[model samples]
Target: MAKKKRFLKMKIATLIMIAVMLVITGCSQSSGTSVKDGSNESKSSSGTLKIGFILSQTGTFAPLSEGIINGFKLYLEKHDGMLGGKKVEIKVEDDEANPQVALRKYRQLIHSEKVDILVGPISSSVVYALRDEVEKDKIVLIDANAAGDDLSWSKKSDYVYRISFSNWQNGSSAAKYLANNVGKTAVVLAPDYPAGKEVLRAFKDAFEAAGGKVVKELYPKLNTNDFAPYLQQASAENPDLIYAFFTGSDGIRFVTQYKEFGLKGQIPLAGTLEFGDELITQPAGEAAEGIITGINYSPYLDNELNKQFVQAYEEKYGKLPNIFSVQGYDSAAIIDKAVTEAGSANSEDLIKVLKGISFDSPRGPITIDPATNNPIQNFYIAKNKLKDGGIVPEVIETVENVTMPETSPFE
Candidate 1:
């Protein structure tokens, strides 16, 4: 498996270079058009388009980031690595899931590396820290996984484009699902951070509006390992269910502990998508089973593009594609479409094209809202189920063309 993964990575990089060269050759022979257009003055003058990826490659969020990287590579592999007749080059920098470090790396990539396009940091805090720099640089920043609701409207910048669901969609979709399918009374818990706060707020507001009752709300500090106190508080309140959002190490620890506390199956757990992530579920073991959550993508989704993606992903990496990987794949798809439709990799042109871009993604059809630079895609409710001796996410419900508000107060 290790050898195969290495080979696939090498193949993705090499094939892209080879394909781009072929396109460059074709362009030179047929069209007198030069790859170096004045639109890319601030960008590298070389015909090759450079993409800078800023995500956690170490620490707790690394696995999620790895999915994004793999998905991006797979998309490049399928397309032979050429985007709009340009040889695309990728430069990656690990932020270690730290905002300060992410900012430093973002500056380095923009200045020294001279990457024309910027991808992501999975942590919302990291994204917030780098927002100013991203705006100053004016490079297209593709949000691969961070679901900070503020990004949609409040902190919305023309330079940013997101393929993933927003925090509002993430939280509210789960609330809608739980209220209709499960019990209407629940407790909401989230880490006290931008993304968490936004997600919790969205859930609380929607659940109440949906004729549900929020028994309690808890905000633990970011990276809290022991959810015992929080769990105890929930048990005391004794709501019909528990709706919470957690990711990274916190998620794994929370579910395991929740089960240990003997509340797993009894209370009926439900929350935002991250808790249902494969990375979190497998580690949490049987603790995660029957946990209902909502997401925009799931390997269980049935569609031609999804089937092709799942098959290609499994063959290449020996695993199923998750929300993180699908987000990365969609990011690449967006880049490919924008670069093609804009007729150049210039930031201005790319932004214009991306606003109206619509394509069939692994999650189904998606379109970017020009006003907010966020996606309009299907929202899915997934239940963690034990399948083939392992925990897998199965899509049970799908909400199509879900979008964010024009103005997000959280920004």
Candidate 2:
């Protein structure tokens, strides 16, 4: 009887040991599976948040585009490559600064590459070409640099939003400054296109309304590198100031030659969208000094966020942040905010969250237009000044935020 009882006890002890081992092994396997699943989930989430960056990496807008890309990358890195807990991935494409190429690239990004968000194409013409496609796909497009008024007015859509202020706003602000502070007689020079026409009209309207006179207006070709002949004509006119609107390399050429021809100081200069960081301050050298231009951003903005951004950008690129950089940084911030508020990357959710949304940007507070998906932001009246052995444009005055007309003629 004692031996039988001892045998039963030994059997029960063995069964209990087997059960304990099984539980331990099961717990180990479950933990491993959980870790694996979590990593997979992270990868999957990261895969879903693909961002498409289309810019003119090799053409007329290269300098501005490079600045913009740097700003975007800096923001992502600062945030540790994650926004709202989703890993961020940027797919860059060069548009070659051509509208046709930009169209194809944009289509590929939307249909084939399947990017969740679209970020850029510096040229307004390029953006105009792809506006329809962007609207059709219902993909949100944050314009980082293009500031043509039509993008926000005539070609407006729910999916399109601009972080940059419109050319009209800049023109208006500049016109007001020239009319009120500077002399009245002015000569206007811009590219021969809709953008040029719009800026000229906006400036003329505002200046004339302020009891100023536009002495002469000239529309030059977009890619014209030689501005001597035109500058001579404007110089002959002897206006109190010249409101020039050339961009890219042409801007540098215009300012440099304007100085070479001894037009500096004799006739003060003012314009919209001409004096960006890449062209006016750096490449134009001392010639860019004292040239007043209207812009939405300046490196010397008195804001904490902007200061940090400029510092990080200078550390990385060894250059001051341009308007394009400011706009691009704002674009990322806007998208991040919308994504966080919506709690999803769905188009509808993003659109709902972005409409009329406002956020602090390097250029001060920026708000989106609910009707046209445009940005409502303040414009700056800046003058180029030499600082730190480099030309640094400083904003001498801040222009009040100008809202677009409720009913634009283009719209």
Candidate 3:
């Protein structure tokens, strides 16, 4: 009887030891830490909520993406590196401005990294390519920069949201400005893509609606470096004004070539807000003066919020915040608001909160359209001016708050 009791006690002791070992193993996994039985030492564990950022960090969209990332980081820093009381981890993947690469990186971010949220791929093509994949994964994708109208209209998805103004929105305002203010006989040039096509269409529709005419239209290849031929064609057209939609370095090249061809003052130039900011203003110097563009946000915007944002941005980056930066910053703010309102980090909950959510922006109050998941906001008409030997864009007029027209083809 004594021997049997002793054996039973030993068995119970062994079972307790095994149970403790199992608990330790489980804790290691849940805590995101590795443990080694041989060392008999437990390492401190840390938890992070991973956020995937896919952008053109090294390619054509680099300049824009860099601004987006900077704005996002600035918001994260202001929030003290925590979102909804969870430590935030930003994992960056360079798409190199290629749609295929962006798609691959997105898959990796979802399947491999298991990120909680995903943002970016600054090119419209990249955004379109991965939209389906992001929907399938049920992840929230906040587009900070891409402005293709199709994403907000025909290809709209519940999971995808855009904080920036669409190319069509800018195009519509540009058309209004040209028809009502500048008056008819305009030559239009944009890249051969959905965004460019949509901008041209909006401009034409609005211009013609206002009793104006598009004298000539040109579609340039996205990578074309030479604008000489295009400029010569535009000059031959002898339109009252020249309207363009080139972005990034292409914008610089186009305007520089326009000056070279002596079309600068002979014919006034106007375009989407992409051309109005520091990117073109500072770099193009005197050449950017007198150019008009439609904008969503300007550092010179007369709002208390904008005033603070511009001051903080200049103090940190030593430059004025561009539209991209404002959009990116607002994107982070929207996400933060959604997370707080939802009271959870769950993607679906956050998404529900995001729908119809409105926030005060540098551009003004912007609301996410439930049907399209895009922002409905105001557009600005601005002119580039040479101030203090630096090119600065001053807002000439506010076009007032314009919503997406019901007749918009994409819708």
Candidate 4:
């Protein structure tokens, strides 16, 4: 009986040693990687402030998201990666341009990663999907590149703030320009999404108010590859001008196909910022030339800060910064300002600090509107021109203080 007891004790000690070895190996692996959707990319630093960045790393929105990340990092680089004298730690996630994936990434950023501030996944739909959750959790979400109108009005949360253009600003500004400068008869087309529909409505209201007629309004299904049929319908109307809002790959395909349909300059073309996005303009080549649009920023804007920003961006990213990057840069600037003013990571304090703050952005002087919590800044009516070097947005007119009214969303 004694001999049997000794053998059993030896076997028990051996099993205990193996279990501890497995645990130690597991710890090493966990420490080496991050807690994401099995992603290996990570950017961590020692700090009191943790900023979680959620944007696309794959799929259609990748280019725009890449620019946004670059811009955000550029600002931090200049500021020594320290915001408001607090060591800033950044956690980035790849949303893959999927709303469901975005939610999962967001939860990790909030609960698992424990980020103090959260900034974007550049899609209006994605932002809306995560909106209610953020409000319920009482987290700070600075709208970087998502320009949905609801973010300003109906579905707004007090904890939410926007540093980018609202759909109304883009549509109304372009509509006013088209009526006064372009033509009296117009046909507009856009992808059938919330942003697209809002653009259509805002444009219609402003154009009609200015004594212009919208002969036809077409909403193609989102992610449409073929714009030939839509272009034909607009041409059949025999309109004096054409306006559109196609984003991502759709934008690229529309501009390229519009020229192929031989309607390039015959009717004259104008749109919101998407029509002149660098991702579309450069890829669409001559098709993008002479396209008139309205936007908050253009790389060619004449300002000391803008010039410096463009130069540094080109050097670092090997490409011209577009509206996405400019908005991303501004988002970082806003966060810095709020954190510095509040001197704490408290959500209530940060929201108060952001409500009425003003700053001189690369685009121009901007302030957070207390009523709508959107940027009250200039919107530019620009024309795309292909120079010997490259195609760029040329500022023709500047509309100052373009913002949403306190009570808006008229039918």
Clashing residue pairs in candidate 2, if any?
none
**What tens digits encode model 1's per-residue C-alpha lDDT throughout 1-411?**
999999999999999999999999997653332222322333334467788899999877888899999999999998888766677899999998889999889878876776778899798888888877777767789989878877777788888888787888888887876787788789889888888888988998888888899988999987787889999999898788999898878889889999999997789999888877777887787899999988777777888999999999999999888789998898888888888888777788888888868989988999998888888888888889998888877888787788788886434
What TM-score would every model get versus the actual structure? 0.87, 0.86, 0.89, 0.87
Clashing residue pairs in candidate 1 are 16-81
State the lDDT of candidate 2 residue by residue for 1-411, as single tens digits: 999999999999999999999999998754432213112111223334678888999856787787778888888888888665578878889998778999888877765666678898787787888788877767778888777787876678778888876777767877877888888889999889767787888889889889899989998888787888898899899888898887778788888888998999899987775664545668888888888887777777789988998899989888778877777777778878888888776566788988899998887888888876777888778887788888766877877766877567533
Estimate every model's Cα lDDT from 0 to 1: 0.83, 0.78, 0.79, 0.84
**Residue 93, candidate 1: alpha-carbon lDDT:** 95
Give the per-residue lDDT digits (tens) of candidate 4, residues 1-411. 999999999999999999999999998766533434322122222336778888877766787788788888888888888777777788889887678999999999977886778888688888888888788777789888777888878888878888887888888987877898889999999988778888888888899899899999999997788888999999999998999988778899999998999998898999998777787898888889999998788788899999999898998889888888888888899998997898766576788888989998888999999888889999889999989857888888888998787767584
lDDT of 4 at 111: 72
RMSD, one per candidate, in order: 12.2, 8.8, 5.6, 5.9
Ranking by lDDT: 4, 1, 3, 2
lDDT of 3 by residue, 305-393 (tens): 89988888888799888877887788778878887788655566777798899989978999888877778888878888888897777
Among these predictions, the greatest TM-score belongs to 3
